[model samples]
Target chain A: MATVIVHKAGLLTMVQDRGRFGYQRYGMPVSGAMDVFSLELANLLVGNDPGDACLEATISGPELEFTGSTWIAITGAVWDPHLNGQGIPMNTAVDVRPGDRLGFRGLRSGCRTYIAFAGGIAVPSVMDSQSTYLRAGIGGFQGRGLIQGDELPLGTYNALLPGNELPPGEATDLLPSDGLTLGKAKRKPRRTKIPEGLIPEYKHEQTIRVISGPEVHYFELAGLRSFLSTEYTVTTKSDRMGYRLSGEPIKHKEGMTNIISAGISLGTVQVPGDGQPIILMADRQTSGGYARIANVITADFTLLAQMRPGDEIRFTETTLDRARLFCTDRHRVIFGI
Target chain B: MKEVTLKYIPSGDSAFIIKAGDVISEEVNLVVRKLLARFEEENIPGVTDFIPSYNELMVCYDPVTVDYRQLLGIFKKCAADLGAMTLPDAGVVHVPVLYGGEEGPDLHYVAEYNGLAEEDVIRIHSSADCLVYMLGFTPGFCYLGGMDKRIATPRQETPRLKIPAGSVGIAGEQTGIYPMESPGGWQLIGLTPLRLFNPDSKPEFLFNAGDYIRFYPIDKDEFEQIAAGVADGTYQVRRTQKIDNGDGNRT
Candidate 1:
């Protein structure tokens, strides 16, 4: 069996799948890859299922050693990765022989990265998911993050193509870094002509729309107006659990001490008694007792995940029709309709 | 009967909330449990999960398959039929515990804070058969009702980083089990040898949303034996309640 040995683990690295669903009622959070787009793309490039388990590295990538021949691809956040003291390109598949060393340095853009293999990593599924929830200490590599000398087992691989025929691309040189070429690399192949009305323009800077929540009346008129109009900067304390936004303190109608704990979800902006807004993320708790003023639509949640700490974010008020249209469009793209 | 107001709030894109009261009350918990039982019997078309809290029920659904309007309709129907629904009969769970010493380090402080002897506190805690109001905060961690008001105390100012699993503790008017080792602010009085949660086991969770629990004190040696058995995978505990079948008998 092929194996990947962890030599130098980054700040935070964990194997993540789509997520643990159908367990929220049991008080389990849907812990998974923070950036779903990149994770799926990496898996797709390697001929694996889109939702297959992949390593999710935060900011920095891990230094690993392959014990057998395997095909691997890297995606998300321009991390300059190198194999055996040579460079490897991002978004393209590469072959690694046994005893080859692979590692990454710092990030060029983006905060997360994904690495997928030809055969998925073998890990036990907890509650039908391989995703790790560190808080509960379960799922993914003995319910913990990878440490030094951890040998992860790889499943058997089916050879679809010869490794010699695969084109070797330029080691992904992170922008603003000195160019040090490794092996002979080829340019990306030309894209095929797309059918009319098939392509969607990638939107980078767009206002996230949200719907008023059950506790909308709890906030004063001015607070609600500020929440919709003003731009708030995401604080450095952001994580999978929630994003703590720094903005005007939302004033409640009354200084309620303790509201009854209720269900919470991703993108639910809860204003605690402290008046600051906490946007719950993928690994948020099942229920909370804070007053939520608005919930970001599912379509815009990926944009929120891409946001870096200190990035300014503005909430745009939109009707349910607009939100539904956005969600339908996203679904169509995902399903290739 | 005291009049109680229940309000429905939207939880998210596909969930609704049925709140009974603001605080933890026996009457509110009873209503919440009864409503959950009715929903199970009806088996609403789109309702995927219904999580009952101390005074609220968070019902989730798939928005693609079911809309908020349809969920609201079913919720209204469930609320209307709630009066006639019979709650599942409560089962008394006698959980053996070892109090104080190495097993329970906070037992002395808890007794001193409540101005009662160690034995008195144990008696008060184990005497009443408490009702499981909700299963939340963590898996199998039951939020129980029926704590004696005389011994009621607030949570610890500073939460313990890791409380051992199966440790019986009290927080405010409610008492609960630490199903897993997690950071909590509850006051620990005793330890139980029972495994509150095990993912490998059938049913996964030891207790459901509406079961009754009683604490029976066990000695240190017994606690060690049971704990060892739990570790080696030989100990088995039954946490099911008898239900009436369609026939003229109870199963």
Candidate 2:
């Protein structure tokens, strides 16, 4: 088995896959990569399945020493990643030799970054997922965040790469180009030669499209208007559990109070008694008592997850049809169809 | 035996909330869990997860795998079968608790707040077979129903920084057992010997929604002995089949 040694554990790093599924009945959270789009891209770049476990680093990233030769793709938040002191581009596969060190020394734009090894980050999966739920101490590496001296095992992957249409030295390689990903674009159902176009630009201020939540009617029209129109700054209290945004207080209707505790799906923008919108994320509780004024649509969920403390975000109401269209478009881009 | 209204509320684009009722009642919760049992037995693909809450069951699906409109249609059909569905027998879990003293830091306060003695509070709490409404906030933390109103107490003005695992607490009308250490405002009245959540063990959670918990007081010696056994994985959790009353309420 290949291994990646954690030289320096970043701010918050853990192994995550698609998420834990089919266990919500036990009140288990489906914890996975907060920005799953980047997770999938990282996996696909290394010829692994979308649900393959990988390293998810929040804000600051780790310094890893690879003990075996493997391909790795870094995605999501930009951290100005470096390989053995040489800079490497984000969203591109970089081949590493045995004993090569990979590290991210500085931040660029995003708050989270993903590094997918050739196969996957080998870890004992709880409830069929390697995602870490720190609150409950479930899943991932020792059911907790990565720390210094933690040696992560890597999974074995197949040699066949998807979109291997270009011959050797065909497309511009972010690093030295002579490997499996060289000729991978000209075949039927053509894959994009370079993934640069697909990478979303991380920004300080972004718009997150949302659909009305079940308790949206509980709020007054002014509250709804303010929610959509005002810029909500992500508070420092944000983590894998949820992001508490500080903005114009969304006023509820007179006599309207907290609803009976109901199910909270990912991206649920719940408004508590204080009237601030709390966007539930990957590690959110299965249920909550606060009223949900809106749910961030699946399309803009990744963008919402990338927002950092003090970063501004505005909610834009979108139709379900439009939300579906956006999700479909992203999938099409992923498959390069 | 009453027919409660079930409304299909769309939650974002990836899930649907099947609201069984506007209020939290046994009838509504039963309907929600009934729909869950029925929905689980279905062959619907793409619907990845189900969360049965106090008054609603949210079904999450992958829009890429199954069309949104098609899933909504499937859920509507599933909700239609609630009348024919019969709920499974409730599992009664006997939980051993060490009440008062250091184990229950707020037990005296609870009794004082309710104007009752601590022993009365314990007797009232342990006598009734409380229904497990749902589990959330933290893993294995159950939302309970059917607590004696005489023992009901308000939450602390300031929540403790860390409430230990296995701590039984009461807040407002709800009673809960913290599966793990978490910061909470609930008034701690006792500490349970059983581990509500053991991730390394099979059946990670001890109780589920639609189950029942009966708390029995134990002495400090018994608590320590049981805790040792639990730590070594030798403790057997006591469980029994809850005999149903004429009413369909699990309580």
Candidate 3:
């Protein structure tokens, strides 16, 4: 099999597939690509299975050299890519001959970048997934991140068609020119009139919608009102496990003791006794003791994940019907249903 | 009978909440268990998993197969019929624990805080039969439901960066076993010699929700022997049960 050699491993690079699902009961987080859209796009460009294992580079990208001919695509985070000392474009396929070098510069806008090769990467599966769970130290390159001098085996399907060449175009045009502008332009246009049959805008700068918590009355009215109206900044302590937001301390109405630990899920914004709100992420524990204030809709969870440290976020109350429609529609769009 | 308010809160598009009560009491646990039993019997469509906490049960469903409203209705019906239902026959599991000394480094501190001798602490802990209320916090980490009131202790002021796997501990009124070495804040009293979870094993988990657990104190020599058996793949700690219903209940 062909192999790719890492020359300079970047900030954080790990092999990730879609994610590890149906294993949450085992206390394992769904460790996968942070940006699913970009990951899939990279795979689609190279004709790999949508769920094929790819390299997820965070903040910065890795430098590598190929030992055999292969087709590859890089997407996400507008990382400046280069092939054999020459700059390459993002979101398109590239043919790399044997002994050629490939590398990426630091990220410009987003936090994650995806690199997908034809046929996908070859790695041992743990718990039915090739994705790396860094916390558990299993799966993906011996269940860890790629290191310099490490050689990754390419899958049997990594072969390119005979005489396949790079698509005919000026590659520079494909490079995202104004990443910041593009991101803002992609958002829905602001409108005053609520059109019939059109899905309502769930995205907002402030006021995240929330339902009355299972233990809403357990907290005093002052604490509840403060949680509903106040703004909280995502703390620097945030990671894949959970986002610890700093805001006003929420106090209990009376002397309350410990509660039994129960099952928790992604987007469950739990408020501990200290009043700090923790928005659990994909890698959160299966259970916790804090009283949950609200659960962010799954549709908006990806957006919340994209927020950088020190970003301010607020919650607003939403009905079940609206949240359901938003989630269903977003899923359909994401999976191309 | 004390009036308890059980609120049904929507968790997300695919899940609903059944809040039994505010505090962790025997009654709340019973209601949680009763609801869990009914959900298992009905096998409602779209319901993938149900997790019970001290006072709430979060039921997650597939949005495509069933909506939040439909699941909520079923939950309400189940809550109303809880009085007529009986808990499933739970299996009993005996776990061998190695208490005090090096194996349980925190045992002395726990004993001193409880104003008892190390041996006395062991007696009180092993005598009580704990219920596995839920499997959460980590894989194979059982949220046990019993702790002698006298031996109950608060968690550490600051969580330890890492606690070894199989470490048994008590936090507040709850007692549990840590299946994996992770950063924990619980006050440890002892440790079990058996592996609680192994990804390579056929049945990755040693315990499941609704199971009964009994701790059996073992000497350091026995603990080492069992640990060796676990590492070498010769130990068989799981007990098999036969169910005639042939439905998906057992699986």
Candidate 4:
């Protein structure tokens, strides 16, 4: 049982995989890594499955001391990562020896970052997912953020699968289901350096792609136009649950503010009576009553998750068909599927 | 069987909602549940998860493994076959609750607002058999229906950040129990000595969607005893098979 010792615990750092699925009907939100693309790439660099659990840090990254030698990679958010007080590259694998401390200096961009080890986090998954839902106190490292003195057990799944855990019959359901598993113990060549073209560049301003929501017709003509045409800044009240944007108030039609509370999804842009739009995120409730105007497409989920508070963003309309194409393109990049 | 009315609406790239009807009624929820049962029975490949709500069922699928067009075809087939669907019997869970005093901070306010005595308010709330419209907001939280309008009360102006688990609250026409401590605005009337949700236990959820809850008042002493029993997983929760008369009208 190898462990990663937390030296200086970073802000809101938690273990996350793709997320917990098959439980939404039971009132559970699919809690997982904020930026899925970055997490998947980070895993790839460390010879882990695309859906392997990794440490996700918000704003500031954590300083961890490795108990054993392993290959580690950091991705998402532009942060100055340091290996034993020396700067290391982002989006690429870095070798670590026993007692070597991994730390970060400064965050250049993005709100969340991922640190993926060769075998991924060994935390026993809750409901088949290592993703943490802090509110419910379920999943991830003790269902909460990383704290100092917390020693994280690391799983050995990168280079080789333990003899007992092989075969599709024994495979567990993980977020972004992995297809890279081989039947035998063979050295899984991890990517030492990722191609420059594959990396996502974070910016202060971004154009988020979305489609009309279930109740888009309930919005007034002006509200609909304003929602697409205007620029909204991510408010300080943003987190994994939802991002309450502060900008032009997108009004609903008269007597259309409320709807029967129904099911909602990730990236649902629901507008309350106050006319302020809130983009549901990783930890949003399973269902909501507020009339929704638009929903961010699945392809742009990674792009939206990386945006920080105060970052300017505008909505661009995209059809579901086009959205599916973008999602397939993403899978091709990471999983080659 | 009632004529099923459904409209399939795409939500995002990976999911879509099957809107049963325009309004929130027992018929609509029944239809939603029936449709959900079929999907469960079919266990169609590529269709991953579902969120069955009051008047809609949100189906989440993996676009990479499933073809959206073919999935919609399966959904349409389900809708066409829905009229022949028969609902499973609903389970009635009798939950013992401690009303008023420290457990119910807003009981007096509710009574005064509704121009009734505290006893009257308690009688009205406890007498009605509430439907489990859905379980949401947090795990094991019941989105109930069938609360008598006489005891209806508005939510608190400022929601409490941490409402304790097993709290019975009423907001507008809806009465719900918080299975876990969460931020909520409903006016609380009592506390139930039951674990609505516990992952470590055999039944992770005490009750699920499409179930029924009947509240019966108990004293604080009994509440404590039951709470202790619940904590140690010793108390047997009271349950009865819902008498399914025609038209979902059970009194």
Candidate lDDT values, in order: 0.72, 0.83, 0.71, 0.83
Docking quality level of the chain pair in candidate 2: medium
Ranking by TM-score: 4, 2, 1, 3
2 or 4: which has the higher DockQ? 4
Tens-place lDDT digits, model 1, residues B44-134: 7766667777788878665545667777787777777665555545666677889878767777887888899988888888887777766
Give me the candidate number with maximum lDDT.
4
Better of 1 and 3 by TM-score: 1
lDDT-better candidate, 1 vs 2: 2
lDDT tens digits, residue span A1-337, model 3: 5588999889778898877766655455666776665676667666666667899886678998987666778876666799998998877677776788998765565556788876578787777778888877888898889999999976634122333343333343123324221111111112211122222222224345555555566687888777877888888898777889898877666754234566676578788778888887766777777776677776565457556577777777787778878767765654452
Task: Name the 10 consecutive residues with the lowest summed lDDT in model 2 chain A.
Answer: A180-189
Tens digits of per-residue lDDT for model 1 on A93-123? 7777778899986576666778887656778
- Index of the highest-DockQ prediction: 4
Worst window of 10 by summed lDDT in candidate 1 chain B? B242-251
Ranking under DockQ, best-scoring first? 4, 2, 3, 1
Worst 10 residues of 1 chain A by lDDT: A180-189
- Candidate 2, B143-209: lDDT as tens digits: 8999988888889999999989999999998788988888999999999989988878888889988
> lDDT of model 1 at residue B211?
71
**Model 3 global lDDT (CA atoms, 0 to 1):** 0.71
Winning candidate number (TM-score): 4
What would the per-residue lDDT of candidate 4 be over residues A1-337, giving only the tens digit for each residue? 3479998887789998989888887788898988888988888777777878999999988989987766778999888898889999998877776688999987888889999886677776677788988988888889899999999987644333332122121122111223533111123534567787877778889999998999999998999999999999999999999999988989788999988888888889999998889999988888889997888988787778999899988999999889888888878876752
Candidate order by decreasing lDDT: 4, 2, 1, 3
Where model 2 places Cα greater than 4 Å from the true spot, the runs are: A159-194, B245-251
